[model samples]
Target: MKVRAITGFFFVIVMLGSVLLGPYVFSVFYLILTSFCLFEFYKLVREGGFKPSRESGLINGFLIFLFFAAQCYFPAWKFIFFLPVCLSAVYIQELYKKTPAPFSNLGFTFLGILLAVVPFLFFHAMAFMNGSENFNSHIPLGFLVMLWSNDTGAYLAGRAFGRTKLFERHSPKKTWEGFFGGVIISAVAGLIFSHYYTELTWQQWVTVAVLISCFGTLGDLVESMFKRSINVKDSGGILPGHGGLLDRFDGLLLAAPIVYAYLYFISN
Candidate 1:
């Protein structure tokens, strides 16, 4: 517990710093994060007796991230044309390889990028959604705040009052009581954030909080499912006492994209 707490403390500092510091720092930090997560995904799949195109996938994934980031800050739509070309490289490169399951490799390669990289790009989109050219950290920062609150609430509540299992097959420790506790805590945090941020109304913030509670839990289960399939206990040992990057950010994976889509449709 001590080691986990120490690791989480510094990890929170870097994450908040990335947003609060500046856009350049935010961009660079997520770029490295996206790349690392993609690498980890490919590594995980490799353990499942499949070979994904690690090099091509990482390159294209980075390019795709740049594409979305460019759309947020730059004026050129022409750059998006390059995405197809990069994707094609993934397929074309498979032809020269000796693997019999080339298409399987191709599919997993794309899946890794889609699953790990694209959502983060949507997260980058959030920082600029308020129509200001400068990157505003409040929206993204509020998101992390609520996610952490939900996790903390769930942990405490589960330890104190957990009974019925939420998803025993995938994650046995999760409880319905804990889940609702997280929702209530995140909802309250969302209301508080709306008071200060003001970028979104309180109702919208609460809705975002609900989405995070439901979908973030799903994200965590999905990552656990992946590890279970591979018969591994943790995704990787990259973060001591915390499992891996995937283990830490699994909630953000599905939640960010879904939240971005929600905010996008409502704004439109």
Candidate 2:
């Protein structure tokens, strides 16, 4: 228990520091994060008796993330046109390998990219989401705060009042009680954050909070499903007690993209 608490404390400090430091730190942190996630994902898939193109997928996934980042930083929409061509290299490389399950290889390679790389790419936009051409840490910081709040609330509430299972097959411990508990806590947090982070109104922050709670829970379930299917307990052991990068950021996988879409629509 002490080890877990210690690891979690340092983990939170590093993540929050990177996000708060500035764009370069945030970008570099997430870039390394995305790469590690994709690498770990491919490793898990390989453990499931499938050979994925690890090298090509990693390189292409990194490039794709940079491509999106470039789209945000530079006036380079035309550069995005190269993404398809780069992705195609995965297929093209697979053709020459003479692997029996070429198609399966192709599918999982792209899956890693789509699942790990694509979702996180939108996080870059959150910093510049206001259309003011300036970077604001609060947007992403609020997201982290709400996400952590939901998780903390669910843990406490679920322990205290959990009864009915939310998804018995994928995640046996989750309960509807905990789910709603997380929502209520996150909603309250959103309302409170509105005063300090004035980028959005109270209502908007609440909406974002609800989205994180709902989708974030779903994201946890999805990762649980993946691990269950693969017959693994945790995604990786990078964190002493927190399981893996995927386990930690599973909520962001689905929530970040959806929140990005929501913010984009409202801002534009």
TM-score of each: 0.96, 0.97
Clashing pairs in 1: none
Candidate 1 C-alpha RMSD relative to the actual structure: 1.2
Please provide, for model 1 over 1-268, each residue's C-alpha lDDT reduced to its tens digit, 9 standing for 90 to 100: 8998899999999999999998878888998999999999999999998899899999999988877776666775788888899888888889889998989999999989888998798788889886648688998998899999899888888999999999999999999999999999999999999999888999999999999889999999998998898888888888889988999899998999999999988989
Number of backbone clashes in candidate 2: 0
Candidate 2 residue runs with Cα over 4 Å from true position: none
Candidate 2 accuracy as TM-score: 0.97
lDDT of 2 by residue, 135-236 (tens): 789989999989999999999899999999999999999999999999999999999999998889999999999999999999999999989998999999
